[model samples]
Every structure is written in C-alpha cells, then in structure tokens.
Target: MMKAKTRKPKAKSKGKETPKQIAKKLEGIGDGMVADIKKGKDPSFKTQLRGRSNVEFDEDRGILTLGDKETTRNFLNIGHARKFMQTTMVAAKTRDYLNQNKTASIREVYYELKHTVPNSKENTFDGQTESDAVIVDLEHSVNTIREKLNLHANPKGTLYGDITLKDKMHHNDKFNCAKLGRGGWSVMSRLEPEEIEIVSVNAKYVLVIETEAMYERLVEEQFAKKNHCILVSTGGQAARGTRRLINRLNSEKKLPVIVFTDGDPYGWYIYSVIKQGSMALAAHSQYLACPEAQYVGMTLHDVETYGLENVTERMKDGDIKRAKEMLEYPWFKNKLWQNQLKKAIREKIRIEQQALANKSLEFVATEYLPKKIKEKDFLP
Candidate 1:
C-alpha cells in the first residue's frame, strides 16, 4: 500500500506590505482628514489614531511624522506631510524589494511588470539606492501566486518543452552513429547527456548547431556516422542549463567548439552570446564559449554551392539594414562576421537550413554530411 503524503508548509510573505498599498491606505486617512476639515472641525487626533496611522502632527515640536517611528520636526502643512508620506512609502518599498530579491534583476522585473501589469509606470528613484530598485510588485506577486498554487516551475534546461520520443530516438541514433565513425567506440557513455552534465572533453572537438530541427535532421540523416566529435545545440541563446553544459564541454571535456548558424544578424548575435556571453548577465563569460569556436554556416556561399538559388528568399529589409549596422559595430567587425555580412549584401538573400531539405535526404545522406565530417577541424 502507498504511504500517506505529507505536504510542506508555505512560506509566509514576511508580512511585507508594498509601499503602494501603504500609500493607498495613508491616502484614505488623508481624505478622512479633509472630510473632517470640510465638516467645520479641526482634524481631531482622537479616533483617527487607530491601526497604523502612519501620520502624526506634533504640535509641541511643530512637526509631522509619516510612516516611520522617527518624527519629522518641521512641516508647513498637512499637504506637505501627505506628500512626504507617499514618497517615503514608495522609497521604503523599493529598497525592501531590492534587498530581499538579490536574484531578481531590475530589468527582468521591469519587463515582467510592463507586460503583466496594466498602465504600469516605471521611474528611477533618484535617492540613495533608488536607481537599482524596480517597482513591479504586481509581477513579483505573480511569481508568489504561482508558488502558492504549487504550479510546476518553468523548465530549467537549455532546451524548452517536452522531450519527445522522436527527439530521444534521434539522439540515440546520432550517438550510435558517432560511435561507428570511431570504430564502434563510444566517448560518451550515455545516450542522453545530463541536463547540466560536465564531461571531461579536453582537447576534443565540439560542434554547435543552432536549431533543433536542423540537429534532428542531421542526426536522422546520420551525419554523426561519419564524424567522431562532440555535438551540441545552442537550444537558442545558451539558457542556464545550456550554458552549464557548454561550460562542462569546454572546461571539463577540454573541447574546442565550432559554431554553425544561419547567416543572419540574429544568428550572428546568438553566436556572440555563446562566445562573449549575454549582456543580460555578464557573469557567465568564463563559463560559456569555447574560446576557439569558429563559425561554419548556412551562409550565402552555401546557398550558391548547393545550387539553392531559387530556395533563397529575399532578405528582410530590416535584417539587411541591421546587418550593415552590425558590420560597422566594433564588436562585430571581425573577419568572419564581415565575410558573412558582405555575402548577405551581395547575394541579397538569406538562406535557411530548411533550404537544404529540398536537396533530398539522399543527397544529405550521401554527400553533404560526408563533406562536413571530413572538413571538421574544431578538434585540437
């Protein structure tokens, strides 16, 4: 018989009320004061001094006090006190959120609130510690709500979505094929590398692919059967898990990787992400790129060599424009990227990996895959 399940207790929110909520409550009290004045009576401190008044007028000291216990000894009027209370409340909350959520990035919180909250206004607090604080409690609340509801946390790996049988089967086939290329020997013991596995790949060659579809197709066509090397897919822009895996492949495995991507600005940026690390988090630089990783491609050169003229599509004007701008940018002025940009301009087209599909799986199985394997030189 199954044992009874024990549930864990939820974490209390530390009763930390947001400044907006505090401000709203204080504003209500101020409204009450206005009502009292309009009623032809001096605002009485008697019944108004109930739960957490957050406002006090010290007649003896000629001062007013807002939320904190400390007194502000000089105030012109009730309006001045009210403004102080509102500003103080907002400032205090912003400080609290930043201090408490160290992992919570300001930009992340800002975007989260901007997208999730209606009419959300974002402003930098000019006072001490204000520049770093983001006022996006609504977004933060969504995360708290999800935790309370016991919803599944978002996927943590580089690859997103469910791992299908087809994916696994394809991975298995590639693993087996690579083993065949090296005289039926396997460098990797497992068919599926751990989500964050660190393999000792020192001085080995690593090949990085861009899209899952391409990876799947290449594996299915048995490209690995002709090449004995480590293969990885960026799974998009080196997500946390992907970054970890790449680090392991580089630091532990000691493999130099070569990046193969679509010949577009987005693809070039993706390669830069793996190489230079994402600007979003500057901390991952030493952990991601395999410093020696050169770029191979679905370049304009490939489009012509493969006789895919008709298959090449007109470059989106925006992409071409950005590519030009990127060519001038200091970071992207390298010979490899310049070559890619020049090709994109001269060809007036962008060819996708899918264009290779029309070349027939037989052609991929017999010629292209073999050529790539023979040319593979990422390994030291």
Candidate 2:
C-alpha cells in the first residue's frame, strides 16, 4: 500500500503584545486599508467561519473549536466585495467609537452605515447581517472580543446573585446583587468585569436556570439570598453575556456551577453550550463558556422520577432529529448522555422546565434543586 502524506501544521505568530497593543492593532488595520487605497489597490480581509461540519470539540479544553480553514473577503471579488466594504466601514466606525470611549449595538452599526453610496443604488449596508458578520470578523482579526470597538451585538440574558460590585463606568458606585430586590441587575448589556468589581459574595455555587419563569420564581423567593448562591438565567439558549458571567463566576470566583433545564434536546443543548460551548460562537469560548458547569435535572429519567407524565409533550420530528444528531457529536458521546438521548427516543416525549410546576411553583427551587445540589447530580 502507498503511504499517505501528512501535511505539517502552520506555525503561529510569535510576537508578544506591548502596552496599548489593542489601540495600535485597530489603528494598524485602518492605516493598512488607507495605504492600499492610496496605492490604488483593492482591500481584503479574512475570518474563521463557524459551521456544523467545521466545528470540533476539544476534549481536554472542553469547548467547541473552529477548523484551520479561513474565509477570505476581497474588494476585487464581486461576490464578497460588498460585505468587505461593509466590514471596513464597520472597523472605521468602531475605531471612532473606541477612541471616544462609547459602545453601539450591531443594529446601530447597520443604521450608521445604511446610506446610499455616491451615484449608486447600493447602500453601505442593507441589513444588520452584513454588519454583524463584520463584527465577528473584527473579533477574530483583532484577537479581541467586546464592544470597545463600539461594535456590539444585541445583549441577551439577566443575572441575580450574591455578588457585590462597583460599576465604574456609569455611576462609579458600589452595588450588591444580594441587596437588589425582586428584580436583579440586567446583565444583558456588555459585562465589563473590570468596571463591576466584586466586593463581597455569599455564593458557594451558581445555579443557572433554563426558564425565565423559574428564575423569577426563585428571585421572588429570594433563592440566592436564602441558599447563599448565585442565580442566573439565559432566558432561552445561553447568550454571550450570560455565558461570560457564568465563566467569570466559575473561573474567577472558584464557584461550582449547576444548570437546570427541561428534558428535551433543546434544553440539553442549553446545558451543552454552557458546559462545552456551542458550534456558532466557538471561537469566543474563552469568555463564553464554563466547561466546569454541569446539568442537574429535566432529563428523560426525571420524567418518571418527578411523575411529570401528564405534562409531557409528544416529541416532534425535529426534536428526534436534533437528539439523533447530538448523538454523533464528540462531546456528547458519553454513556450517560447517550442513554439519556436513547431514553427520550424510546419514550417519545419531551418535558419543559415549567412541568416542575405540576408539583408546585416552589418544588423546583426548594425540593428538586436542593436535592440535586446535595447529591451533586449533574451532567458534565
């Protein structure tokens, strides 16, 4: 048999960053583009794309990762020119925002660039997608992620916890999460940990609830205060801000994190994104995932365990498809998760986090959660 040739890996850049490296990086990108224009040369850029086929899970690191391939954008290429132009415009706008010490959402970036080009029907950006991709590109190119470029995506998720911090950006005053009333602080906005200092904490662990309703119930019951823990809700799928807070809590505060979600593929996915990161935003895993986080309940076994038979809904075709697809994923190949998926297929049913309500509103918080935490019943 003939031997197959194996290619060597590309060597990485070895330069270390100096002080004000970020500011210089932003300036360098813009300066290069201007130099290209001055020389009558078309501009170009590259970004690592995230897709199902290209995403892989690093077992040791416990986060999804991108492949070696890169997507290129050049002004001379008709197919990519418009987006390339939009990206450069976005970078320029972000530079201004950063210089001025301000932030703007992806939507704002769209509107800021949504204007007709001179003597042309084409607009700088027809929709938000054009600008959004550009921001992700910036994240990869600059080797930094955050809205300091004045480029930010719409923030998602909220947090209630036993953390006390000072907001240096706005009020420059101290605030405690435990002291907040029923409504906790809105963490959907950009969470600059440096600005919000943690003064004191009563939490031994952090509980990330899947459903907003359950989170509100826990908040109303003063769950974090009573249990001496941090309570967080992503509202649905874990968002960037929500994940950042969880990762910060786990890595920085040395806190154990537990997640509660329904017994379904989507719910399971929520847990996966927190524990092992997701395919879409895998590149930003450093701040967006807490691989140490674990899932507690709402598994197929929980259906029988909790007697949630009546509340169980029939699993749809899509639900089954998602579960089967998850079985093939490297990170989800463990026997526990495989069995959980097989059980769901055999049962042909799905249950929501709200199904815990069948017992009582407080059953999840008081009975289910405490027992799970004590037993250390979590899926890694």
Candidate 3:
C-alpha cells in the first residue's frame, strides 16, 4: 500500500542573497579594476572561452571536463576590449539584482541591458541570444550559475515523489510532489541549492523520465509509491533545475538515479546531459551534472529483448548526425555505447519510449523496470 504522503514542514525560501554579500561581490569587481590601474596593468577580466577546444571527454570520470585554456579580456586587446567591458557591466548588474533580492529571466536581462552603450554606438545587446551567451560567460567567470544572480531560464520540467521541498520562493510551507494533485512542482525555475530545502526524502531512488506522457502514466499508477522511487520528467531536454535536483539527490540525499528514455540518439543525448553534463554548461558541471546516475533505458538491444522492432521507427538524418558526434566523444567510446550507436546507424532505426505503449501503459513500471533493476542492466 502507498504510505500516507504529505509535506510535513513549512516551506520558506532563504538566501537569494543578503545585502552584505551582494554588496561585497559588486565591490570586488570594482576593486579588481582599481588594483589593476594602481599596478599600471591593463584592467581585464579573465574567463575560460567555452567551446569544443576547451571541453574534453574524460574517460576516467566519464564526463566532459573543461580545459585550463583561459582568455584575458583586457581593455587593451582588440577582441578582449569589448568583452572586458561587457563582463564588468554584467557583473555589476547581477550584483545589483542580488542586492535588491530581485529575480530576472534570461530574456529580462537582455531587455534591461539592451540600451546603447555609453561610449560605443552599438546597443548593449541586439538580441536575447547574445545576452544569454553572456550570462553563461558570467557563470563560467564567477563560478556561479545565473540563477544566483537572480536570473532564470523559462522553466521546463516537473517532478513527483515522496520527497518534500521547502522553497525560498514559497513561505517555507512544505510541499511534496505526491500531494500536488497532479503536475507536482513545475520545475521551470532554476533549482538553487541555497533556496530549496529537501525537508524529507523517504524515497529510495530517483527515476528520471524523458517523456511527459510516461511520467504522467507512472504517477497515475502510483508508481513512486509502488516502486519506492521519485519520478522526474524533463519534457524534452532535462533543464538545469531538473538536473541540479538529481545531482543534489545523488550527492546529498545519496539517492541512486536511474534515467529512462527512448532508444534513439536524442534520448541518448538526454541521458548524457543528465549523467556527464551538457557541453554548453560544462563550466557548471559539478553543480548541474549527476555523474553517478545510470541510464536504464530502452537501449537498441532492448528492441530485440522486449520484441519491440515493429514499434520502432526509422532514424532521421538529424538523429544519424547526432549519433556520429556522440560516437567521437571519448566518454562514450566504450564498447557498449559504440555497439548501440553502430546498430542505430546501420539499421537506420530508433525506438521511442512511447513504443512500449503496445505492451500496456504500466508495462514500463510492471515489466521493464523490475527486469532492468534486477539484472542491473543499466548503461554505464
């Protein structure tokens, strides 16, 4: 029987930032500039240039690691000139936001800074994409995510579980995913560790689902209670909040994480993002990536094992391209992953998690899950 599920503690958000800490961070940027001037050195801000060259697949850790190649965006260099100015400006603005205890989205940041630069004719930012990239740069430089700077992405995921959360956004009134009628907590917002308190976590493992339909079906069936696990769904690509929550569970709550997705390149990439960290946000890997998480999937072999070939669909061009790229990455160079990719490319077929629908909605919970868990058939 499902245990009586209820959120016990009152939830309250704490520590977006106090005035003192925010002021200090803002002042530090100014001080760094002043010291550079005093030392007769060019005022510069150093940050890692984020790209393929800077990111490498770590075979041992099974994650993408950032390289030590650094770029000093100084007021003197031709290229570094504008970036240096932008860095300080963004830092100052972020500190201001934190000091005010106000939050903004990536889009909001672009609008706020979209005015013409004081000295230069070009507007602060021509597009949201530009500001978004700058926010990532800020994250890399400051060793903090944009959320702490009071900036958030449009939320994109949901979670359901026996675990309870005390959010800083809420008044610390505790809430559990199981109690949320349906939909649980819409995790579109960022999951800042300092902001959310995991008041209670009786669940044993975290089951991350890629499809919303599957997540809903499982929730309807009371799968979390039946299996003693938390269910999370990232509508498509798992967002930062979803990924961060998984990391916290693995690192702090010590909950084993199992990722369930379709048997395709896209599904594989989703699993990669959860386990090894996203290449775009590689700088925040430690906070966002759950390296210990395992992929318990709809692997290509599952096509035969579950007798799902008829339900499989043909692979698309984009799918083939992505699979090729993943094949080159060292983190996925292992024989198991290589064989799966090769099978997909050669067969030109991909399976969706939904295909298992033929077997019945509860087929995943009642059949796939138990067998995978018992056999330890997770993709490492």
Off by over 4 Å in 3: 1-23, 35-41, 118-120
Tell me model 3's lDDT, rounded to 2 decimals: 0.80
User: How much lDDT does candidate 1 score?
Assistant: 0.45
Estimate the TM-score for candidate 1.
Answer: 0.49
* Lowest summed lDDT window (length 10), candidate 3: 1-10
TM-score of each candidate structure, all chains considered together: 0.49, 0.89, 0.90
Ranking by TM-score: 3, 2, 1
Clashing pairs in model 2?
Answer: none
Model 1 Cα lDDT, one tens digit per residue, 40-128: 65542211111123333222221221222322211235644433333334334433443443223333333323322236452333332
The candidate that wins on lDDT is 3
lDDT of all predictions: 0.45, 0.77, 0.80
Question: Where in model 2 is the C-alpha error above 4 Å?
Answer: 1-21, 37-42
Model 2 scores a C-alpha lDDT of 0.77
